[model samples]
Target: MNRVNQVVKMHLRNKFTWFLVPWAILGANFLINAVIATSLNDGEVVNTGAIASIFIYTLITGTLTLKETFPFAIGLSIRRKDYFFGTALTVLLVNTISGLAITTLSAIEQATDGWYVRLHLFELGFLKDLPFIGIVGINIILLVNLYFIGFTISSLHRRFGSMSMYIFFTAALLIGTITSYTLTHFGLWVEIAHWLANNYMDLFWWMIPMVGVYMIISYGLLRKAAV
Candidate 1:
């Protein structure tokens, strides 16, 4: 237990990778959006993908967390299971903090009408309509799933080298293409869209199980991983 706490504190103390860098990117995006908003004279510009940068940043951070920390943790005589659990704990804690902060900013954006400049940065259509708790839930779930996916991918690289990663991605791309082709052939786009519209929030719930799956896979790979 103490070792787990130490590991979490070690990552937390680094501050730059898991915390500052990601927020810095978000701040930069906000600044850019603010400037663009000022240039626009009449209407609102919906920056639907602006918040996405932070999530993507989290994925990179997660990958780096394991890639950079696992070796050091092992050198310090930390057990692999403890390190894995600690990393998982850090992911949850960091994502929860980020999710709450984003949710608050999103609420403010809604109330101020995008800082009175009519630039929709944090408030996207899907997110803006959700209640406060719902928004936080969605953000946390998205962050967790993305981080775990990145962590799992890094674990794969650690356990099976770069070739396996390449093959996995190629197969995923092919499978995705085939699935899309099948869906298009059946003209299920509209139905899919409708379902998404009605149950988008429910989809976030699916991330819980998805996260669990990734957690198990990452731990399994890490157990056999070379430091």
Candidate 2:
């Protein structure tokens, strides 16, 4: 338990990576979108979707976290299991906090009428209709899911090298293409969109299981990974 805490501390030591960078990018994105929204006509709503930058940044950090820290932690005699748990704990804590912050900002955006510029950066579309807790829950789930996705990919690379990554991505691309083709051929896009609109939160909940699977796969790979 102490070892896991130590691992968490080690990762948190790099405050710039875990804290500053994502928020900086999000702030910059917000400012740029705000400026654009201000130039638009009155009553026109601008749904920038720039809020996604933070989540995407989370994914990048997840991939980089293993590459940057795993070797050093291993060299320090940290157990792989402890390191994995510690990393998971760190992400969960961070994402929970992030979720709260985002929800608060969304509320503020709504109250302020998009910061008085009609910019719908945070309170965009369907998310605006959800309750506070629901919004936060979805945000945390989405962030954690993206993080583990990157972590799992990094783990695969660590365990199997470049060739494995190539193969993995190739397979993913092929599968994605086929899925898209099939969906389009069946003309299921309208139905899928309607279903998603009605049960978007359910989709986020479903990601919880996949996040667990990613964690399991990452732990298994990291256990046998070379330093």
List the candidate 1 regions with Cα displacement exceeding 4 Å: 43-48
What is the number of backbone collisions in each predicted candidate, taken in the order shown? Answer: 0, 0
Task: List all candidate RMSDs to the true structure.
Answer: 1.4, 1.3
The best candidate in terms of lDDT: 2
The residue-by-residue lDDT of candidate 1 on 1-227, one tens digit each, is 99999899988998888788889988999998898888886776546577889999888876777778999999999999999999899989999999999999988898988888877878767666668998898889999999999999999999999999899999999999999999999999999999999898788889999999999999999999988
| Candidate 1 residue-wise lDDT at 13 | 90
The prediction achieving the highest TM-score against the true structure is 2
Candidate 2, residues 133-173: lDDT per residue as tens digits? Answer: 98899889999999999999999999999999899999999
Segments of candidate 2 deviating more than 4 angstroms: none
Question: Whole-model lDDT for model 2 versus the true structure?
Answer: 0.92
**TM-score against native, each model:** 0.95, 0.96
